[model samples]
Target: MGFNPRDAIESVKDIATNAVERSADIVDSAGHILKGDVSGGVEGIVSSSMDIATHSVYKIKEIATGRGDDLDEIV
Candidate 1:
């Protein structure tokens, strides 16, 4: 059996093509994961901020209407 240089070159090309394709896939997957994590974090922060603002507004309204007074008046 004789070693053919052409066959060896073709085999090397195939290996290189597969490696490049796999690397691209890995990078794409990582990008998707990062985007999901960042999106979730931003959503959480916005939700928490809205909840705090709602509570603060409720408390302000109560105080303004004298409903939060703790002192008793002598009539």
Candidate 2:
């Protein structure tokens, strides 16, 4: 049997998507377990974690695009 490019692409895509979904579920579960770590509080921990993740992603994009400090100073 001959190898088909379309079928190969589809198989790879399915594997990648499944892996991503499983990893996300694990993170979600961990977050839920820690949501009340601060005497049943949920603000400081979750909010700060989300902010850091978002900022890191934004910084990565800016640096990757060659914007560096210029984009930060402008924004």
Candidate 3:
């Protein structure tokens, strides 16, 4: 057995990518169909969703790096 740095790096990348994709999906599915204030503008929802995805990716990066301190700022 031996340490595989590439494997670890790939794992982290996968986690971050998955987190971002999932976050965007969640926001698109739920945040864009409210039929209320801010719902009439798709651009606004998309911008908000990108913000959310960015936050989610940051949180995932924190977790992947084993430094989740102050993660509350994400949610």
The most accurate candidate by lDDT is 3
Model 2's alpha-carbon lDDT is 0.52
**Candidate 1 clash pair list:** none
Tens digit of per-residue lDDT, candidate 2, span 1-75 = 344556555545655555565556556656766765543234444554565555555554454444435545656
lDDT of 2 at 59: 50
Question: Ten consecutive residues with minimal summed lDDT in candidate 3?
Answer: 1-10
| TM per prediction | 0.40, 0.37, 0.39
TM-score of 3: 0.39
List residue ranges in candidate 3 displaced over 4 A.
36-75
lDDT (C-alpha) at residue 5 in model 3: 62
Per-residue accuracy of model 3 over 1-75 as CA lDDT, tens digit each: 233566556656766776677667656656656655455446665665776666666655564554555655545
Candidate 1: worst 10 consecutive residues by lDDT? Answer: 66-75
RMSD of 2: 10.9
Task: Please give the RMSD to the true structure for each candidate, in Å.
Answer: 31.5, 10.9, 6.9
Reference-based lDDT, each prediction: 0.50, 0.52, 0.60
Q: Is candidate 2 or candidate 3 better by lDDT?
A: 3
- In angstroms, give how far residue 38 of model 3 lies from its true place: 16
